[model samples]
Target: MSTRTPLDVFLSDQALAEAREQAKIPGTLAIAITPAAPGTQCSWCDCDIALNETEHRCKGCPNPAAVIMHQFRHGSPVRVDVPLCTGCHPDAARFVLALAQAGGTR
Candidate 1:
């Protein structure tokens, strides 16, 4: 015994269709697969650094776009690397810490 209004039935069918469509699409549908390459400058300050010495820095504290993309891909958070010299790492770290403490909305 089941009772479903027309709207409910329509929504259920729509959802099922959408799910099937999504299932048929490749996992990396909208994502670009870039070859691994070293960055040349800080993502924030554009400071030059050794390509091999670059560090992974989230684009933003609690990067919302990364979070959303990661969840959509059903994978771990996306990390973006940028070249930051040893002299700049401490300043960058401090900025990140401050952003974190300020609720990371920025």
Candidate 2:
């Protein structure tokens, strides 16, 4: 039989509890970025969520706190409630490139 020290057991339990707590948080949804014109899918995921050429970022994405505060006064660039999935978000360089091609921004 294997033996686990008391400290190890306690640490394991603590980790499990922390994981459970984190699991309760809901995951974000994904959105696609397409061209301003019609008849095409998002340049990244091809989901057909494009809006316009000047607009960037997903419609309802959770932006940084500072950005939110600044943009709050002026209102949001895009007022839609649809957010892009984390995978398709314009976070990575490659993803940003694809989004830019589709008229989206990073």
Candidate 3:
């Protein structure tokens, strides 16, 4: 659980930077955020994230890059906003894109 509120994460400087870098590029997989006091591990990967908190929350950043990733995962449309941290945000974007381009044969 993150000690920072949605607003706090929304106004973070570092978080904004990370989001800007990927803002132009679309992403599907959104990693739920997990806040740590100082050296806590990321919920989806290895990184502190520090002030880059909003990167994990769709509501936090309100970026189009954030998505439900899969409707079947929960069977609902209201869950479209999935939080993601800076560490995993970029990697997940690249990964999902690869899968799509590779065409796993749906």
Q: Rate the local accuracy (lDDT) of all candidates.
A: 0.37, 0.34, 0.40
RMSD of 3: 13.6
Q: Per-residue lDDT tens digits of candidate 1, residues 29-63?
A: 12211111233333345344566866845443321
Q: What is the lDDT of residue 89 in candidate 3?
A: 65
> Would you estimate the TM-scores of all the predictions?
0.30, 0.25, 0.28
Model 2 C-alpha lDDT per residue in residues 1-106, reported as the tens digit of each score: 1354677567645654454444344431123222122221222333345566445553343331111000001122332322233344434336544654674432
- Model 1 ranges off by over 4 Å: 1-39, 46-76
Residue lDDT tens for model 3, 1-81: 336677655645344344344333443222232233333333333344666586654323322222222211122223223
| 1 against 3, candidate with superior lDDT | 3
Model 1: clashing residue pairs?
A: none
What C-alpha root-mean-square deviation, in Å, does candidate 2 show against the real structure?
16.8
What is the TM-score (0 to 1) of candidate 1? Answer: 0.30
Measured by lDDT, the strongest candidate is 3
